[model samples]
Structure formats: C-alpha cells, structure tokens
Target: MLWATVDVWPELEQAVLVEASASVRKIGQSLAVGAIAARADWVAGDATIDLDGLGPADLVSAAYVLDEIAPASLPKLVGGLWRLTADTLLVVEPGTPAGWQRILAVRSQLIEAGAHVSAPCPHEAPCPLVPPDWCHFSRRVARSRLHRLAKDADVPWEDEKFIYLAASRQPAPVRAARVIAPPKTGSGKAALKLCQPDGSAGERLLSKRDGEVFKSARRADWGDTLA
Candidate 1:
C-alpha cells in the first residue's frame, strides 16, 4: 500500500490519490483506505537513496526504474529492494530487447539472493530464451482525443509492450507453461510458442485431432498459461 517514487510529480500523486479515494468512497470503505493512506510515507528520492529509512513492506516494486540505473549499481539497488520486501518484489521495464536483458540480469541477481521467481517464468532455472529472442507481453490501450493529438496518430488503440518480474521470499508454486507469442490459428490448427516449467521453451502445435486441448489452445492468448 506504500507508494514511493523517484520522480517529483505532485500532480500525478494527487490525481492517483484522488482516484483511489473516490473508489474507496464508492465502496463505502473510505475510512479504511484513509487510515492506510495516512500511514503510508511517500518518499521521493533517486534510486541511490537510502532505503534503510523506508522500513520493510509486504510488497516492493520498482517500475520503469531499472532501465535508468547504471549497470554496475543494479546489484546493489536490487539487493536493497529485496531486503525491504517482506514477501514479494516486482520489477517492470519497457518491452524491448535491451529492457528484457535488464530484466534477465535482475532475475539472476534476485535468484542469487535466494528469491523465487513468482511469475512470467514457471521455473527458477536460468531463462531458456537466448540472444536475439526475449520474453515480453503487450497490453492494448485505447487512446483519448488528447492522447491522439499529442502523438498525432489515427489509431484508436496502441499496444503498450512491457516486461516484468515477480520474485517472492517463499518458493513459488508449480505452474503450467506460459505462452510467449500470439496464437497462430489456421486450417483448424493452432501454433503456440511456449515457455515450459522444465526450463525449456518451444512451439506447440495442436489440431482438431487433439480434441479438448485444441479447443483450449484456440482460446489461449499471449501470456496465458498452458498445460
């Protein structure tokens, strides 16, 4: 519940706080939300800021921040974040090859610190993806008139691609393989690129001949889990 940021965006904080307050009021839990918000210490500092003063939280997140960090300082920063994470730590970055590489490096660092990979990967073993290939996902966002004007675009929506890692202090539960690409369906057959729990990744081809599995494959999307 503690929200901290390195940037000094008073307007951003106020807007989000107002929206959250409104949501709480609508749900008739304004008092409860108020108490939590009141207790939260909003600290604004750079990545190198001392975390010792921030205390521990159940969940810690570093979003769009790692890409700004120097390569040599990443380990130290990650170590500090992990230390403050009482349960889980989340890190997010842009969905580019370079961003994925940064996430991969952070994943290894967290694993070395005895953290478990809680998401995006079913296994804690080294990533199966090699150079020239990286793991990322996309979300479609509808653009507003102002947004369209700013970008000078005509498209109603755009894909916001990103990559993230979730690491937990406890071991992660067993999970099914993850789909890494958009499903390709044709001729009553479906092809999916999957990252399996066995620390391997490859394509899975299914046809109507496969029965129920084929039906499931047809409904699956990128980032979904498959058995």
Candidate 2:
C-alpha cells in the first residue's frame, strides 16, 4: 500500500513508514520518494505504546504489520493510529482467515472511532458477510521476467489478492456497487456477485434482453465498482 499511495497521491510532500521492529528497513524499501521510515519509539517488552510523537499524516498506512501484535492489543493500537490519521487510514492484510479477521475488527474500530469508509464499503453499518467467508479483492499486475522464471508461472501477469480498508475523516464520495467476485458471464447473460451500499451480498443477473445493463455487466470484472 505504500507503493500504491505514491501512485494514488503523487502530490504528497511527506510521509512516514512505521516499522515493526527497531530495524528501520521495515518496509524493505529505501526512504527515497519522500518517505521517512521510523520505528515506534514508545515500546516496552511485548507491549505497544501509543505513537503520539509521530504526529498525524494525510495518509497513515498499517500494511501487513498488525498480525505481529496480539489480538487483545488491537483496539488501542488501531485507535492510536486512528487519532494520528489526518485524512485517510489504509490498513492492508493478507487474504487469509487471520488477515480477514483483522480487517473486520479494525474496520469496526475505525467506524466506531468516527472515521468514514472510503472504499470497498459504502456505509458504517456492520459487515454483511458472516464467518467462513470474508471480504477481499484482487489486483492484476504484470510479472517481470525474473518473477515469472522464479515462480515458473505460465501467465505473464499475476493477481495480488488482499483484504484492506480505506477510512477517512472526510466524507467519502458517492459509492458504486462493488463486484465482490469475478462476474459469471454467458453468451447472453451475466451473473454479478456484489456488495451493495446496504452492506448486503446479492446476485444480480443481467440478460441481453435488458440491453444497456447487460452491456455494462460485460465490461465489469472482479474488483470493479459498478454503478
């Protein structure tokens, strides 16, 4: 998400990268591109202290870092970050059971802390998906030759799947229904699995007989926000 933030908001003049340990190279990248990699200064043994000195940022990101902390300490950790977030808070986790659980928990905390959801959800209400299922999305990225050779992958590109939340103090723009999964398309019909504004999962079937809506479905893919 740090790399993504550089792309999403190129105008950001300053940023901070929170490290899991005293090692400043927490993110495995350089401090170039105007980011300050800093460790949590206020830490005791097995306890995470509040990072009040770091100050607030326009974009605060906790990327795959929370899984290292105990579940019981989540609320204070999340709430502290929430307080430091000036505009947006991006929390990213793996597409696994534990990761999804963290996403759900942190999302509820963010909502409770009065932050507005900016993506992947349309409202502050409870999540609609129950246990054994979680909300996640995939983004396709081109694989470098070295990557393809190392993984022995057939495709020239790979899908990076993750579960994340984008919350902000500012109001989010109008939302469109998200394609929670890949659309099932047929010769003249398409079946869309969506997470709607009401935070419920529903299937929308569009037939060619419906004309325009069908055309739109044909163009929609997984992870797309459709109107």
lDDT of 1 at 227: 57
Q: Which stretches of candidate 1 lie over 4 Å from their true place?
A: 1-40
RMSD of each: 7.6, 4.0
- Among the numbered candidates, top lDDT falls to 1
Candidate 2 ranges beyond 4 A from true positions: 22-47, 142-157
Lowest summed-lDDT stretch of 10 residues in model 2?
A: 38-47
Cα distance off (Å), candidate 1, residue 206 = 1.3
Error of 2 at 119 (Å): 1.6
Tens-place lDDT digits, model 2, residues 69-144: 8888888888988888889888888777688889989988888878899987877778888868777878888999
* Cand. 1 TM to true fold: 0.80
Structure candidate 2, residue pairs in collision: none
